[model samples]
Target: MSTLNSSFGSRFGLEYLPTSFMVRMGKREMMVCRDFRKRFYAVNPIMECDTGVQAGHLEVLLFRRWLLILSKSKAH
Candidate 1:
């Protein structure tokens, strides 16, 4: 895997237009989730969306979790 795939990499999401360049994140020292969302949807550049979870896989995982909870509640 390359640097872009790692947490140390400079990956970001292009979900929407960035209203501001950077926004405060942390409570103490201060942090931000900057909108270089444009940085990802480049014509020729680095790859990978900022999201870590796969949506399809997440859906299945969530279903399984909900089923587990239901089963536990109805256990006899």
Candidate 2:
């Protein structure tokens, strides 16, 4: 997908979601802190749109970490 075409349209039901590339990036910025080397200094837990047919070690780690993040959705 083009970075320029970065947002979800209202036609897509997921428009309510903040998962567009830019939005994810914004959230990542709000939560993640970096050091001089741009390594993780502090960060609130967040998940990524991981893609693979089979789970790798890192995928398992992400899965476990994602489980720690609680979802408190009020939308029904």
User: Over 4 Å off in model 1, which ranges?
Assistant: 1-6, 12-31, 39-50, 53-76
In terms of lDDT, the poorest run of 10 residues in model 1 is 66-75
Q: How many residue pairs in model 2 have overlapping backbones?
A: 0
Global lDDT of each candidate: 0.22, 0.26
Candidate 2 scores a C-alpha RMSD against the true structure in Å of: 14.6
Candidate 2 per-residue lDDT, tens place, 1-76, comes to 6343422223323334443222234322111112112224443345443222222211111322321111122222
lDDT for model 2, on a 0 to 1 scale? 0.26
lDDT of 2 at 65: 34
| Top-lDDT structure, candidate number | 2
**2-49 in candidate 1: lDDT tens per residue?**
321212113223224343122222321111223232233333232222
Cα error, residue 24 of model 2, in Å, equals 10
CA displacement after TM-score superposition, residue 60 of candidate 2 (Å):
9.1
